[model samples]
Target: MFSDLDEQLASTLRHRAGGDIDPTPIVTRARARGRRLALRRRGLIAGGVAAACVALTSVVLAIPGIRGTDDRVVPATALLLPQAQSGAPVRPGEVGADPATVHFSTDPLVSDAEYATWRSGRGIESVEFRGPSGGSRFALARTEVLLNELQQTLSSAGRPQPRSDVRVGDRPGVAWFDRSGDRQLWFVRWQPAAGLWAQLDTYATSRDEAAGTASRVRFDGAHRCVVPFRLGSLPPGGRLLECSVTFGRSAPGSFIEGALVVGDDSGRWLTVRAQVAPNGSEARRGDLVAGPYRARRQGSDVLEMVVMPCVVEAFRKGWGDGYTEAEGLAILGGYQPAADLDRPDTW
Candidate 1:
């Protein structure tokens, strides 16, 4: 009866047969085809369910603080420094690295030069790292200058209260918080070496962030010396004992003025100082020779120094009787061209 029957015929005969079908190869084949179609439909539905589960899993993983147990937000990229190790444990006195070499974990709020200039006028060499907002400013300064400033700050207001002993990395440090009127200041200081110290100051950031930033600071070496400018040649047996560079603007242009005090074993001292004006033209400040330097006698004992064009010349003369005029002249004559003494690194 089903010899020439198509799918429509098979369906009609199966329905007409009520509850039973004759035991034949054609009926058996038709039943098997129905089962295969049902399996295919179930497979498609299963595939769709599996795809939805995968998509939901992906979304859950992408949501913040949900996919895994770890709650900390891992930074995608870290700020890099030329001489810093990433994610290294830092300790006090472990590395007397220059503050300039310190790399914060976050992007800087200001340029390096601007940070340098900001501290130049304050009589200290410091590198500042700011948080994403205006209220977060952190600074690292040399130990000597930092300590001096701390002492001054404390003494100015009776006696400053100390927070507690703090450690950054392996370095032991101290902390202090000050609130005066409308301003609040927080400070953390640590020693990186026998004679070197590092400081972190925060204005508007949380203490934790400041501490974390301080701990993140690391250097690749034992120490890095970053000077504002390079020195030419010193007088014979003349050892540099003290120096300070100040950054400021002049009518002609930006200028840097500083004093370099040097002394020898003879108990003699020579003070060399010059204010460089960035006029890019010749300038004559006084009656000293005006080629690249001019010298004038302020008094019988003091010699005023000046520079011209773009040459680095020693301009000041405060010498004891032990060192002779010829020696001073020799010290000034060995003037290095402007290449050696560039603007302050911060400038």
Candidate 2:
């Protein structure tokens, strides 16, 4: 789900799409995804009807606390775990939070390092503390689909010390140097927990230094993977599935990349992807969310706009004729973080 898409699809939360992005493949596959999902949704509906028939014959007792799916007013943290709520401890298995809602904080490189620079991401779950002066440059992520592929970026150098096993603190780790670029990029991978893995792209010139940096990655804190924008309501029959944010490299607050997914009862998905624009002017692309144009992408109606440093969109995929342009705009208009696009700390 992570890519240089450096793109923000939920999966796009890893990296924002670049100039070289070829949308042909993704657009092609996405074109058929809706039909496949429609078939699956029908099956689910059929099953529900049978269950409903059974319930009709039973003497139902009143359940005082039963709740409906909609109108549950809660903060965006509705997607987060109790651990992220107030720095409280959660017993193992006590929480089953969505991967999109999970974010982790790492210990500082220096004892006196500030934690504010650590931004949320990797589905916007794992957090990495960025050093301004550049000391502790490490990242930790919860294990998911992207871990192995990311670690495998290193091509087989087939040269001196291509790959080696190392220890991160007490955990077993792998260290490798990617010689694909003009400079060598050191990488290390290890498990912070059973379902969680951590990665470190080290500047260290030696294997020992690389391992040392990775070993420093301690999953010390948790937070909601907060996106720069928010949704006041959801698409009809849709619920939030995931939301991810990516910060700029040169300046953490200078740019923001993000994605949010809302899935409906029909098994269709609505995605809102946001990223900074290449041009300095927002009007270069038009403020789409302001009065979003109902354009189409990959066979579905899409609402896209340019809000200055941010280019935002909400589009449909995976089954059914879903949200109309009006519906999509409601989701997009509710979030107006243009004032804080460069304020990562506020995120």
Candidate 3:
């Protein structure tokens, strides 16, 4: 209890001094923040302008045939069969007028099996046969011109398949055994005629059964290869490889209808095929593959498709650069088959 309040007065003065502090540092920091924000906003606007220019350029370049002069690759139709690209194109036919025809069978080549479907290529034809066991290829040919080619291709040449010399009746032949998982596949090739050869293949069956099936192939028919649709000319230096269709009196819902395979001098191949819509096979729906195909299938090299009630798919079979989807569709435009595609009478 001192008479005068000196300590209290000193405390009060200290508080008043602290309350009246300098505001210069805070003001300076706020000014610096404002400048930074303004710079950032300007950068954002410039970046957006640059991005817009790039997008505009890309959109201009994306049009199909907008390249400089003849730099674009448009779908061109021409007929050049096993000839040089520089050669003059031949006259376009109302249909695939390929002179090369394979020997064909009107009846089932295998006696016990039923003839289901068939396909003909440049110089060859193969028929599909089905029975209680499964399906197989039992092909009979009338001419010998394509026998050597058949032997070479079916034999697989350099990287060869294991084979054995077999005799179907008095006709000497060879057999190839392909092992896939738990099943064994058999292909027996025999000289049915003096100059010509025939093939009998089993999907999966005993070797004895395969040999017996091979001996039963009937070789008495003169059927010619006639195309269903008008061919839209081939690519330069392209040759027809195979033409396919589904045929059967019993099976109402055929698997596939029309296909055309074109090959270049370099051995690259392209296939365009139109198939039945609502096919029972899950494999045949989206991508139309080129194979012996009665079951599951994977896609070819490059595939593109469209739905026209009948599904159409085309693919070039190699990793290298090749034709575009537009080009493939143009090629397929030549393959619209007749309504009675499954009937031999119409074929």
> Which segments of candidate 2 are over 4 A away from where they belong?
1-85, 88-102, 106-146, 149-163, 181-183, 249-255, 264-267, 275-302, 306-311, 315-327, 336-347
TM-scores for the candidates? 0.45, 0.51, 0.46
Residue by residue across 107-138, what tens digits does model 2's lDDT show? 32333222122233223233332233322334
Cα-based lDDT at residue 125, candidate 3: 65
Predicted model with the maximum TM-score: 2
The predicted structure with the larger lDDT, 1 or 3, is 3
lDDT of each: 0.39, 0.45, 0.43
Cα deviation in Å at residue 138, candidate 3? 3.0
Ranking by lDDT, best first? 2, 3, 1
lDDT of 2 at 257: 50
> What lDDT tens digits, residue by residue, belong to model 3 across residues 75-143?
100000011112222211211234233243323233333224445655456655543345566554445
